[model samples]
Every structure is written in C-alpha cells, then in structure tokens.
Target: MLTGQKRKFAIALMSGSTQAAAAIKAGYSEKSARSKGSQLAKDPDVIAYMHKTRGVEESANPEVTKQKVEPEKMPVVNTLTGDFDDPLDFLKSIMNDRSEETDVRKDAAKAMLPYVHAKKGEGGKKDAKLGAAKAAHSKFSGMAPPKLVVNNKG
Candidate 1:
C-alpha cells in the first residue's frame, strides 16, 4: 500500500536517519518535511512496511513503539580474520567501510597505510643518504683520537 516515496521514507527511518532528514531523502518538500515525516511515520502503510522489512510479526507484537532501534552491531575486526585474504586487505576494508565509526576507520587507515605506502621518517627529503651520513659522523665527533706515542712505549 505504501507508495515509492513513503517506502523510501520508512527505509530511511530504519537506517537511523532523523524523521525530517528521512523525509527530505524520500523526496518530500523541504518546507513541510518535518510535518510530512511525522505524519508519514504514523501512517499504517509505512508502519506495515517498516515492520515487514524488520521481520516483526504484527499479530505477536502488542504495541509498536516509535523509538529508533538500531540493528545488531558488527563484530570488531581487530586481527587478521580468515574471512579476508590478508591483513592489509582486512584493514583496508575496515578503513573504507562507511558504516564504521570514525575512530575505528582512522585506526584501520593508520594500520593499513604503512603496508600500502612507505613511511618516511620525520622532516627530510626522500633521498637523505647524505643527512644520514652526517648524523653518523656527528655521533663520533665528540671522542678524541688515541695517543700514538703512548702506545709505542708498550
């Protein structure tokens, strides 16, 4: 019974979008979106659609609450699970997944970046062989040379 826009509104609501936002996404007029969303949410057809899609039984259910119920949480992928081919692939997937939390995605990106791109040390050009050599020279610059004449007395 739900039309295309109404169905879309229900789906957007199920996906955790606010009523006003869901209405806008469903192609409702912005000026009256809030009122439209509130009315659409109370529509029996939209309610039925949402209930059907969520796999809830109309008969068994007593009262239908308007509160947002999020779907089951995705399992945390900390280590290299066999489901993915390798560690890099696994991390990349986590990083790219839009549904993932911002912090988690950032962590995944940090974990995956070293493998995909080379990590350069702090503040230097790509070819810093001369700088490295200078560092080594500086390391030994403090020590004085041994006394050659004293060694001859032995």
Candidate 2:
C-alpha cells in the first residue's frame, strides 16, 4: 500500500488520467477533485514528472499547414448601360426601378379618381355628386400632405 504524498503521485501516474480523475480514484471526495487538479497542475514536481513520462520535448502533435486556394472573383454588371458587370449591381438597379414604379402608380391613383367618378355617373344627381365628392376626398386623403409655401412678407 502506498503512503504519504508518494501514494498520491503513484495513483496519479497509474491512472493515466487528468488530476481530477486520479484524485477521485485515490479515495478523494468529488468536491475535492477540482482543487486537487488545480494544485497538481501548479506543482513543479508533478509538471516535471508529467513532462518526462510523456516524453514531449515540444507539442506531441504539430500544427498542419493548410494550402488555401484563393476564391475566384465574380463578373460585374453595369446597370446604367444595361451591361453585365457584377450580380449585386444588377439586383440594386432592379430594386430602384421597382421603387420608381410604385411612386408613379401612387401619383396616377390620385389623378385618375375624378375621371373614374365621372364615368360612374356620379356628377349628375345630388346623391351621386355627394358620393363622388366623398370618394374623391378619401382618395387624396391618403397622399402625402401638400407642402406649405407661406410668404412671410405680408
């Protein structure tokens, strides 16, 4: 039966495990394993023994050098002249055109309501005229508020 600190050292050596595992196998409580590992890791004698036993001059496993292949550059698309330069530029131009079309549609909606109401025969009768006025008002209500051009010199 091993005795004293040598018993701990022998158990640590035979276990071929981490200090925590060695401590636990040597009758130490679970809670003491962490402290035992930490102390063992800091011990000069234990470190020298481990270094000698493992026969590791430097790192046992050397880092492997990876050969990196450079990524191929993509072709560009010129949007203004409708020529292919980069794919990203093509997508940006398409989105801009879509936004312009949306604005045009909104303006057209504001302008076309009166014509639409007239075609529905809404201008002749009093009830029809009131309904047309209500419809026209509602249509323009959703448009951006008109810019106020105030002359301060009154």
Candidate 3:
C-alpha cells in the first residue's frame, strides 16, 4: 500500500495526463498530486535534472528576474552666456569670414547677441546677474561682428 506521502511524491515524478492519471488511481488525491507537481515544477534542482534527462534546453524567463535599466546621461553645458567656452574666439573667427553671406553673419550675431547681453547683466544689476553678464559680454567681445549692410528698399 502506497502511503499518502509516497503517492504524492510518485505523482510529482510522473509527467503527462496518462501517467499522472495512473498515479492518481494508485491512491494519490488528484488535488494533492497536482499541488505537489506544481511545487516540484518550481524546484531548481528538479528542473535542472529534468532538463538533463529530457535533453531540453534551459531558458531564462525575463519576467522572473527583470530589473529597471538606468537612463543615459545628458551632456553638461556651461551656465554662463549659454556658451560652451569662456572666450568665444572660435565662433567669432567663423563669423568674420569675408566670403560668408551678410545675412548669415547677421543671423549668427543675432543668435549670439542675446547670450552676450544676458551674460553682461544689462537687464539686472544684481551681483550674480552682473557676474554672469560680464562673463557673457567678455566672451561676446572676443568675436568680431560682421559689417552692417544698408538696404534702402522698403
């Protein structure tokens, strides 16, 4: 006579419906047998042994051990004048080219003007504001502005 524990163990070892049904007939309660089978399914050693015995490949379940991936870092920028360099001489040299279009120079100057003005503390006299403005202005002064064009067309 198979004891309840041995019947449960036998049910867990058997696979498939026919084998499991046969084990159940031999005295294991279907519910207890199925529960034990589920427990055995979760056993790492049993799973590994089953893999070797059945010649089955073991695969990791992504859901079982997922971790949150960190986001990529953004490039840092200098706060002063919103310019990367302390002295923007390089920008000035590029803008000062005589062969460059007048409009292109004007646009570049216009874009850089705001950063310069902001850095010079023109709008606010606060020490921090003044410091930032001075830095930006000094950087701006390094860049030579393109000549102005007179357009008489209305």
| Best model number under TM-score | 1
Best prediction by lDDT: 1
Q: Which tens-of-lDDT digit does each residue in 9-127 have in candidate 3?
A: 43335333343453465466787766655554455654443343333355587442222212222123222244445435545644675544355556667766766667544454587
Measured by TM-score, how close is model 3 to the native structure?
0.24
**lDDT values for all models:** 0.76, 0.51, 0.48
The collision pairs in model 1 are none
Arranged by lDDT, best first? 1, 2, 3
Q: Which candidate would rank higher by TM-score, 2 or 3?
A: 2
Candidate 3, pairs of clashing residues? 119-132, 119-133, 120-133, 121-133
Tens digits of per-residue lDDT for model 1, 103-123: 668889988887888767645
Q: Which stretches of candidate 2 lie above 4 Å from their native place?
A: 1-16, 58-154
Say which prediction, candidate 2 or candidate 3, comes out ahead on lDDT. Answer: 2
Off by over 4 Å in 3: 1-15, 18-31, 60-154
User: lDDT: which is higher, 1 or 2?
Assistant: 1
Per-prediction count of colliding residue pairs? 0, 7, 4
> Model 1's lDDT to the true fold?
0.76
